[model samples]
Target: MTGKLRCAVVGTGHLGRWHADKYAALPDCELVGVVDVDQEAGRAVADKHNVPLYDDHLAIIGEVDAVSIAAPTSLHYRIARDFLSAGVHVLVEKPITTTLAEADELIELAARHGARLQVGHLERFNAALMDLDLQNQPPRFIECHRLAPFKPRATDVSVVLDLMIHDIDIILSLVDETPERIDAKGVPVLTGDTDIANARLQFPGGCVANVTASRVSMKMERKMRLFLPNGYVSVDFQNRVLTRHQPGEREMFPGIPEIVSEESVFEDGDALMAEIRDFVACIREGRRPLVDGQAGRRALATAIQISEQLSA
Candidate 1:
């Protein structure tokens, strides 16, 4: 709240290492420590970031005002529960936890402890996504495709949790309504878990989102197309570009044209850094986080439905 907020990066694996670097480089945050089950890897990240390393999170939980939980999906609930119980604000990575019950418990824990819980839906911080004027109206229909080549690093969970959950969170945020029904299906291609998946979410507000994510694609692509009453918005995550097709006025065309295209490229910014900044800002200002626990729960609930359907 004062000079600099102390922060720790937990689960110093691939993603957590980057989280540690961001905290270390943030002007208003002091990187207190990096915690990981792998002591050597944790120490390496700490050394690189010039922060202390701890194999156990308990040692540093009392010291940091806020922490980023970038650990595996399986460990999210336990680690975050412990930190939040200690009154430490947490920024947890997506799919919040393996089960919806776990997510609910974490949300309750944060509320009970008066600690802020922010989910790591980093796309919300993307400059391209942030520029969208989603204030007045929610999306009517959405399509998302997040495809990537297989990487052995994040195989602990299914592609739904590993990748599709990102789009699920984004769609839920845009729609802002409870999904009435979700018809989903997926297949395991490369790993033991489902690799490529698709879900059609029907929201009570009549907004439908057709989401697909695959980790076995030959070419990498992360894009979403939003269709609203007034216009269509297309976002390219990898390219940092947002294009809109809105109806043009009489000056631009004889009558109102069916659509007029406008393209814009966002200034290159680090989304992960922005996400961490938001977490620190919320912790400092006592302002509610953009992707709060409720938002995360919505996404997680949708994902759980998809997974259940897939399993069935």
Candidate 2:
């Protein structure tokens, strides 16, 4: 922990390139290398950072202190396993893996090897959500809508995993309990996989969340609304705006209290960099990350359940 932590990025695709950018920009971290099946894509990122490019993730295992695994969802398990087993810290992207067993194995392996495993639930570091305390004012009902135009690059998976998983992680964190019932429906449009979906989750804690995700929409939107015991909150993830409605001391009527509204626009910032910084800090400080392997597993488990319901 005294010197800079040598880091490598696996799978130099869309998000993986940004991972390399942050690792190189951070003062306490050194961008050691990058990996990809497409050598041209991988070399572009590695060359930008002046680091070597490897054809396989395992090629850089022993040389790196940590790695950011942005490989394809199916390959997440294999690459993360080798790195964790070698005692190298890992910051893997969303969903952790395609199956619960794979996620569990990664969690267990990280523990056994004493290596830190963090998931790229990047929204956790959003400026708008930074000061929102979910524990103190737990929500009774939640609503989320995430929409994006169809892109062939991300059609490998359903919209549930590609987009909705972000809100799933956030909602699960706020509810802090397993859902007692899950009602879901989805259908394919542009691709064979589900392009639009909705899931209504009823938690054991008397909380309900209605989540929807669409990849065939004409316009992009990311928003969430929460109904609290004494107030309401609206988070515009796309614009980084947080709005709250609560009761004021003054009354609008003889027996009713007046409603007070407040809104704040947070600076649109780089959540990816913040996520990587936390990953490095967790490795150095010997603490669990905000979105550790267990947390990611929980989100993935719930997502898989929802996906199953859709298929049924």
Clashing pairs in 1: none
- Residue-level lDDT of model 2, residues 1-312, one tens digit each, is 889999999989889999999999999999999999898998889789999988978788789999999988988999999999999999999979999999999999999999999999888888787757554887999999999998887577799999999999999988889999999999999899899999999998899999999999999999999999999998888888889889999999998999999998988577898899899999999999999999999999999999998888
User: What does candidate 2 score on TM?
Assistant: 0.98
Locate the minimum summed-lDDT window of 10 residues in model 2. 126-135
The TM-scores, one per candidate, come to: 0.95, 0.98
Q: Clash totals for all models, in order? A: 0, 0
Highest lDDT, which number? 2
For model 1, the run of ten residues with the poorest summed lDDT: 249-258
Q: What is the C-alpha RMSD of each candidate to the true structure, in Å?
A: 1.8, 1.1
Judged by whole-model lDDT over C-alpha atoms, candidate 2 comes out at 0.91
Whole-model lDDT per candidate: 0.88, 0.91
Q: What is the lDDT of residue 135 in candidate 1?
A: 43
Cα miss at 152, model 1 (Å)? 0.8
**Candidate 1: where is the Cα deviation over 4 Å?**
250-258
